[model samples]
Target: MPMPAQEIEELIRAGIPDAQVEITDLAGDGDHYSARVVAESFRGLPRVRQHQLVYEALGGRMGGALHALQLTTACPTEE
Candidate 1:
């Protein structure tokens, strides 16, 4: 089964409590998604590590239940 956007958002939020997550259905088919996550926890992490954290949040569903996800991450900019 394809993972729902809400589930994806919930997983990310669970992994990073302080994250601001936005999930978009790129292909309109529910299997492909784009997620933009912003969090203070990502502040010092490299982009690759940041993506890894999000992947961990998915709990090994990347190629199974969750087919494809285009993920982007960033730390909150200081005002």
Candidate 2:
């Protein structure tokens, strides 16, 4: 089954309790998503690493139940 946006947000929040997560369903299908994740913990990480953190939060669900995710990550200060 395709992953729901709420589930995605939940998983991310579970991983980063202080994170602000926003998930949008792209293509009107649950299989594709766009997520904006902002966290204080991301302050020192590079962009690639930031994305990795969000992916890790999904517990390996990407490409399986989650399919594709276009993710954008930033520190809280980045706005």
Candidate 3:
């Protein structure tokens, strides 16, 4: 089974409660996706680390329910 966009968002929110996430299906197959996330937790992390956090949030689903994810991570902008 493939992961739904809402489910992906939920997983990311679970990882970073205050994260602002946008998810899109890239292939229309539910396996390939793109996600943009902004969160306070990512304020001091490197880009690689930020992506790692998102992958971890999926709980090792990278090759299963979730396949390819083109992810963009950023710290929350001051407002």
lDDT of each: 0.95, 0.92, 0.91
Q: Taking the tens digit of each residue's C-alpha lDDT, what string does model 3 give over 31-69? A: 899999999888888999999998988889888888888
- Per-model TM-score, in order, reads 0.97, 0.94, 0.92
The segments of candidate 3 whose C-alpha lies over 4 angstroms from its true place after superposition are none
Best by lDDT: 1
Tens-place lDDT digits, model 2, residues 1-79: 9888999999999998999999999988899999999999999889999998888999999889999999999887642
Q: Which residue runs does candidate 2 get wrong by more than 4 Å?
A: none
Tens digit per residue, CA lDDT, model 1, 1-79:
8889999999999998999999999999999999999999998889999999999998998999899999999999999
Higher-scoring candidate on TM-score, 1 or 3: 1
lDDT of 2: 0.92
- CA lDDT, candidate 1, residue 50: 96
True lDDT of residue 63, candidate 3: 83
> Between the candidate structures 1 and 3, which one is better when assessed by lDDT?
1
